[model samples]
Target: MKKMVYASLLFIFFSTLFSLADTTVLKPSKEEEIRDTIVVHGMVLHGRVTGIGPQRLSFKLRYSDGTNRIAYKDIDSIYTKYNYRISFKRMDIEGRIVGIEENKQYLKILEGNHERTVKIADIDNFIMAVSEDDSFENVVRNKFPYTKGSIHAGLEVENGINRKNTADVRLNLKRKVAEHETRFFLNYNFETTQTADEPKVQNKDELIAAATYKNYFENEQFFFASLAAEYDRPRQIQQRWLPSVGYGYKFTFDKAFWLEPAVGLAYATTQYTDIQYQDDQFTAAALRLSGEYLMDDVIYINTLIIDGNIMYYPSLTAAEEDWIMRSNLGFSIPLFDFLSVKFIIDYTNDSNPDPEVGNNKTTSSLLFGFDF
Candidate 1:
């Protein structure tokens, strides 16, 4: 029995020793070989400096190479001991397969040192590039264009005996092309008002009609325009026919503020009853100057307008002159990607006031429109 026990002990010692040796020699299987090669591209990886000074830097990069295994390595390079942000763009970083052991593969980087092993299939490519020039180019391509049209109907109430409240309808169609530098517009408006307050007044309700066509061209430096118009209206004690032509120029500063000055000429004819009281046609001319302030994104405020007009009638052997001033405060709000709402309040003053006619008029309006 003692001999049997001694033999058993000897066998156990040898077995233990052999097992230890086998553990030291153990390695990954062949199935892990494919996982050793990984391709990386377009990635911005961050790292910290482990060692500093004139020698070489030991950087440990904690990054994933398109694999399940996280990689950590110390790269040896001549760099300062400071934190650095590095970005890779449109380039591939490849690691060659070295070995596979215990169902795991080892990888070695070809270019950068202190590299560690990563699984082969986990590398990523295609990173974002950074540059001011690229950003400016994007702005040019993504610029917002300004173009719109709208139709509005409202009720206009006036204080007069012959006129009751009437429906005022206006249609405006406009299009902007050439990067907000050129625009074409067509507008028509109709309203009904009371005839003059006199014993001889014939029509109780008078129709006021007007139409306008205009084109505007602009650039970074200046704006130019051409305008034409026709009007049939009876104001105060006289009925008038007017047709006009105009041109204007705009000046800009700081890209946010602008001033425009315009001049126009109109031919006028005055009449009373069925008989033409004033057959003479007179030329009318006016100068207008206005200023505007632009807010960020889609809002703006503007104030400043001045106008002067002179009218002459040859048949009536009479001449009339008028000067008008007006200002507007407004804002543009964006409602959607392509729609907006504009609100404005207008105030006006006339040099000649017919007591029967108001010398100053204030009006407020809201416009719903679209941008193309």
Candidate 2:
């Protein structure tokens, strides 16, 4: 009996060793293997639907390609996970998928006319189905480019102690030269003012022609420069011709907030019909600093802005030599992609004493304008 028990123990130990060796040598089945090769046709399974159009549907299809893994535009009539049947006008296109989140799907087509990726997850009926057509890659390559023009019209009101109370009608036209980077702007502003000491003021107009260049620079730094020529016709004073150069720089934080610092210089000369006040030539320099926080793509909340300017009269006689300083504080809000409305308070002071008029005045204005 002792020899039999010893023989049984030896048999059990060898059996266990043999079983371990067999388990170590086992291989995976065909269905469990990963595939790397591209596969043209496979039955659609569980995947996300990313885009929908009037005549098209776009989604991603995941499947194994015999050797590893592959993904492509599944533009086929495949059943969605929810059980509705869907079809595409195209299929098997290559594109990047962007913005994928829980219960959300987005895909971008890198090729053809529809280069933009779209998001679609709200369609209720078509959960699972299959249909096919062209590929998204071919469609995105054929989009066309075009230009657009627009007009702005608004009313402005201003009141001041030493200056006249004014009401104005404003009109402007702008055309886009390049999608969002460059533009041509033309402005015509006309105002009428009334003062207690002066005669009724009428026909104050400023005509401005300007061209602007924009740079989408590095590190969220954006720069813009413009050259402008203007004719200012005042009912009470001589008409003036001014040429100005200005540049602005803005540093953006994330996509929503930015700080802009700007400077400008202007050379102006007046033409007189009566010469009651000497026709003079002057140089004006201006500085502006502002900060804007974007609430959204279309809305901006102004945090702060300070604008200051100095005017030097170079052609005046010794007795009439004078300088003027002006400063403004304002906030602007955009109403549309191209239109904005502003509220501003301005203060002005002159160095020369005019016995009839005070040296300082405060004014308020409401302005509406547009950008191309």
Candidate 3:
């Protein structure tokens, strides 16, 4: 009888222990309980917030195929279950975004049951959430601010009555942090031709470099300044400088494309490499009219991308017939996650050109490159 009683007691104790263990195992951790959610145009998106900008929000969709980058005014609301480190002009806060007041231009954050309101204009930066296992070293190494750039190169060789070799390299770098955006561009091309009657001769050597900066403001209006320099040996242009400043507005048409039209005053000066072309050198005030366009997933095909820009400088101080126009267009198709094949066409026209070289120049290239 004593053995039977002891056995019953032991079984009850083990059972109780097992039940507690099972209960503990079924409980979820805080990370598993929290999820990031965004509501835009009545559509609820369950995803991780990749970035927050003054005018836009970048989201990594949980159930979608592509990233969602929408203007702040378009997003109805956002909620972050985990704490995100948000920076302002003079202070920083660690909290979750509970609400977004688009009309009032403010954000409601929850910190330890206390709600605080912060103006959108006061925000300087927004970083993604940090994980429990994330150390300071790892965060710095993994989440450091970086620029996006691409390098494209192409070569063409032909053999016939005249052997011709042509090569070109182009580089583009872009960085957008908060309200400031910057871009840098470089392109170089070389060509050589050899005839059976003569030795090989270099016919083309061209280099172009340009840098632009923009300070964004409300309602897609911004202030922009740019400077560009060019050298074309084939055209007898030793150097050319273009500096412009202007006010511009961006028009976003849905999520597929945008167009920006800008008008401003500019100054252009040219130096000729040939002594006989000295008369062509001139510095003059000009009216700068430029337009830029970008389209992604063209026609919803999801693989084609098109981007281009056109700049027309009509000389104000120089003769009426001495205007210049430059236009570029590019088409790209992604071959991999980071690699793409691009075809580009560049055209330049100078109303006044060296008598030896023509007034129009056109170049096209097919290049392969990867973006980082």
Candidate 4:
């Protein structure tokens, strides 16, 4: 009987040991993991990923060699080190929604093994959450808008300074806040011509400055306004100021072409150098049409931008003294990255001009300036 009891006890002990061993046996981990191995154009780079953008991948080696750059195209493949923080028992049901069956009260998505019957109304956000791997450009354009300014300098070498001394100066600047835009423009022309009797006579002197503000809508309609000030020595005008408020509609067929039609009322103030009329002020109705065309793909030209605007002020007075029409044609040619040559034509027609000044005036300028 003692032998039987000892044998039974031994059997029990072996069974308990086998149970412990079975419980201790470990299976492969459930988490999905990968090692860091990035191959770029047949080159192997080993480092922790600091940044991954659409244009390049940034990483640092074991030693401080600074951040390295690898072209996205040169990257043959990528092996990321997946250090997951949590592991679930079942496969995740993570995916985008395709649709929902209202009758069955089930949400149909592109992924998931479980029954997805979540209500769409319960979702708080519409757009997908921004991932940590988004590109820099993408973030700048979408999440947070940024401002960049550049200055360009250009020149003309047609005639030497001794023969024809001419210089064109131009400037352009713009600022944006959400849908609102404000722009500033300035152009000046100075020329000295040499004659038989006169040496380097100052012939042309002109200046134009303008500031415009516009609030745009999603549907392309906009409320616009402008304030313009100008001066011309030859035209016998000491100063001219024009302020207008208007509405405009933008027609955009493509990225290369767009037009805006606008109408408003303008108050014009002119202080003339002519002895007959020293100052004059009037209010008139104004109509404007402006457009832009981009020709940057031309082989010989680095960039060619053509823009034009026409402003017509009809007679608002019975005497027809306030009628005026002004227009402009401009060209911007970029020779290099931050350098460009600008050509502009300014024309004005005033029905009631100063005594010595004619009824029409046309001025053209070639300017070189730097943008920074």
Top-scoring candidate (lDDT): 3
Regions of candidate 4 where Cα sits further than 4 Å from its true position: 1-164, 318-320, 352-356, 368-372
Model 2: per-residue Cα lDDT over 256-298, one tens digit each: 4556666666555555444465665676663445565533222
The TM-score that candidate 4 achieves is 0.56
RMSD of each: 21.6, 19.9, 6.8, 16.7
How do all the candidates rank in terms of TM-score, highest first? 3, 4, 2, 1
Look at candidate 4 and tell me the lDDT of residue 26: 47
lDDT of 4 at 244: 90
Between candidates 3 and 4, the one scoring higher on lDDT is: 3
The list of candidate 1 runs beyond 4 A from truth reads: 1-148, 152-172, 175-247, 270-280, 290-292, 297-329, 347-355, 358-360, 367-372
lDDT against the true structure, each candidate:
0.39, 0.43, 0.75, 0.61
| Candidate 4: clashing pairs of residues | 150-371, 150-372, 151-370, 151-371, 151-372, 152-369, 152-370, 152-371, 168-367
Instruction: Candidate 2: list runs displaced more than 4 Å.
Output: 1-110, 113-167, 170-225, 229-237, 244-248, 263-266, 272-274, 282-286, 296-372
**TM per prediction:** 0.37, 0.40, 0.64, 0.56
lDDT of 4: 0.61
